[model samples]
Every structure is written in structure tokens, then in C-alpha cells.
Target: MPGPTDHGRVLVVDDEPQLLRALRINLRARGFQVATEATGAEALKAAARSAFDVIVLDLGLPDLDGLEVLAGLRGWTAVPVIVLSARTDSSDKVAALDAGADDYVTKPFGMEEFVARLRAAIRRGAASASPEPAIVKAGDVTIDLAGKRVTRAGEPVRLTPTEWGILDLLARNPGRLVGQRELLTSVWGPAYVGQSNYLRVYLASLRRKLEEDPSDPRHLLTEPGMGYRFEPS
Candidate 1:
């Protein structure tokens, strides 16, 4: 409903008083409704009670492990959780991600980087892929534009906002080869159209998730020096 830049709620869960204060001040300054909790139990309760746009979670807690809190939250909520902790080991990061953290930020992080990551996570969490009500069919992939859903060969497919936006744009212009410029502009906005690397990376991910053979894609066809096309089967 509202744009991402508008006011939204954020829950900062950490035992450290200094970090909690800093996050509260910074996030409030950036136009977010901030809530702070000092324990895993309180974090879980807060999650259950209120709708939080993004969660800045610390790995170590006094009562319960942060991983437990992450798992608990993921059980019922897809609320974007960003793990912020001093644990920089690969294992710790992987564990948090595996437990369903949307993003991970290590401690001693730059405020700019932290804010950027937070913005991206929040944008992704709240972004609606579909612009208006319409059903788009491209091969086995059926995108219910209004419903904001995608299904492949009768099986539902879960897509992030960015992935769904890309698919929706391509489906809207079936049979026409949507150039890199148009697709990028349509999905990520004009400011990002020149970032070819972004297109390449996301296309690869989409193909991997949707195509029968990512190497030899059936529906998502890449036009070298051009862009991509969605050919319905």
C-alpha cells in the first residue's frame, strides 16, 4: 500500500544496550517505527504481537540462542530478518541464513552499509510484484498478476519480489523479445537498466528456478546482444 520510504515498523533484538540505542536512533532518523527487545523470548513475543517490516537480530541472547529465535520466527512469519552480530565466521552466517534469515550483517559494520542492507531487505519484503490485476501465461509458467502468485505446470512457485517482477514484465509481452533495457527498466526501474551484471545474475537465478534445464532453457530464452523472451509452450 505505502511506499518503502514511508514509515514502517522495525524490531531490533539485542542484549547490548549500546547497540540497541544506536539502532533505535539511526532507524528512527531514517523514518521507521522502532521497537527494541533485550531477550529472545521478548523478541518472539514482539514478533507475534506486532507486524514488523524488518528485524535486526543479534546472534547471542541471554535466555535462548539467536538461531532458535530465528527458527521460531520463521515458523509463522516471513518477516525479513537481518542477523546483526559479532559472529563473522562462515558457519555462523550460514547457520543464520539456513534458519531463514533474509540477510546477515556482521558487527562493527558501517552504518551506511547497514542502512543500505536494511533498505534493500525492507523494499524486497514489501514490494508488490504485480502492478494491476491480470493473469499472464508464458509457457508452463502461469503468473496470476493480481493475486501476486506464480505457478509452473500446476505446481506453485515461490518467488521473491524481484524475480516475480521480472517474470511479470516478460509475460506481459509474450512473443516479443523484451530487450535488456526494457526488462531492466520495467522491473528494477530506469536507474538500474545500465547495470548489465544485475540482469545477468538475476536471469541466471530465474532460469535455475523455472527452467527444466538451465543450460538449455525452454521458456526463458536469452537473446545474446539483445535481451530475453518468454516463449510459452
Candidate 2:
């Protein structure tokens, strides 16, 4: 069993089977929960389902390009990522860094240096993990993100697990439009990306409970055929 001082969760994305196995063992031995993916698509999908403390991504992937995967990750979460690739050119390093990678390491690197860099990257991530207020108020709804509770007009309101999931994600990104696919991937898993009906029904229920007028909501809003946004007035 991992102790309280266990490092953290990690997702490693690379195509080399031997490299993946080595990393899984090495990381786990150092008190980290490790998950590995060989393809960029699966890596992005894994990220959607889990909250990782740090990610180790390779530039060369079998399915989608690594840069594409990086972009996909940046679209939603701000998780720290360290890139690993055999590409030794300074340009490759620069490109990865410019694409939101926290750190980049060339292939065939020593374990000591890699581990040191990983720790340093994680420290930076944690240091910059600024605190956000747990209580959010918008119109008549008071969303307690930490407690997973909601209230309207000073009275408690009940929400199903699915309803709360949708509201929680949208509320966190106040003023930003969350795409329908992203919402589904985050709350309902990657398999539910095409299930827009689930969102429509849940969103309607949420508006009825939280919005002053469900017919013409002021906070919980839809962007036609696009997605949803949460505006805190």
C-alpha cells in the first residue's frame, strides 16, 4: 500500500513497450501511482478520466502526434507535463516548451537527472497551484464546490450525481465556454463523448433548480449547438 507520503499519480505516454514497462516499475518503486498509454488518443482519454499530479509525455506517438495531445490536454486542465523524446535538437525542445510543456528531457537520459527534473517540475506545479475559493455565488445559486452542495435563494437544493457533475465543471470555468465533448469526457468519461442528450436533460434540470427562470436562464447558459458556459453575476 502507498503510504501517506506517496509521491503522486502520474500518466506516462510513449510508444516503446520496454520504456513504458521500465518507467512503470521505476515510478512505482519511488512511491508514485503510474498509468501508461502508447497512443496519443488513449493518453488524452486517460487524462480526461483521472486527475494526475504530473504527466510524462513523449513527442513521438503511434496514433496522434504528441503536440496534438499536448494541445488537447491544455484545452481543459492545467496539469504539469514533462516531455520525453529522442529528438535532441534544440528546436524540438523549444517547440515542446512553447506548447505548454513544463519541462523537456531528451531520450536515453540518466534516471537520476530525470527523477530530479520530475521532482522539480512537480514542485513548480504545486507552488503555482493557487487557491480558488470553495464557495461560488451566481444569481440565486450558491455552489459549494468542496462540499458538493448547492442552494438557491438561501434554501438547499438537491442535485443528482450527474447533474452536480455538469454544474461543477461548468461553474469552475466561469465565463468560459466548455465544449459539449469536453464536458462529456470530463464528467461521463471518454465513452460518453457523443451522448449530448444526457447533457441536455441534466442541464435542463439544473437550470430549473438553480436559475431564476429556467426558460431564460441568466447564469447557466447554452451556446446554441456549441456548448455551455457558467456566468457568475
Using lDDT as the measure, the top candidate is 2
Q: Cα lDDT of all candidates, in order?
A: 0.80, 0.84
**Model 1, residue pairs in steric clash:** 139-232, 139-233
Best by TM-score: 1
Off by over 4 Å in 1: 1-5, 128-233
How many clashes show up per model? 2, 0
lDDT of 2 by residue, 1-233 (tens): 12477787889999999999999999889888999999999999999998888899999998888888998998888888999999988767655654567778988988879888887767656654657569989977899999999988889999999898999998786765666766888898979877889889999999888888899999999976557889998
* Every model: Cα RMSD to truth: 12.3, 10.7
User: Can you give the TM-score per candidate against the true fold?
Assistant: 0.59, 0.55
Writing each residue's lDDT as its tens digit, candidate 1 over 182-224 gives 5677688769757768878888898888888899888888867
After TM-score superposition, the amount by which residue 160's alpha carbon in candidate 1 deviates from its true location, in angstroms, is 23
By TM-score, how accurate is candidate 2?
Answer: 0.55
The per-residue C-alpha lDDT of model 2 at residue 223 equals 72
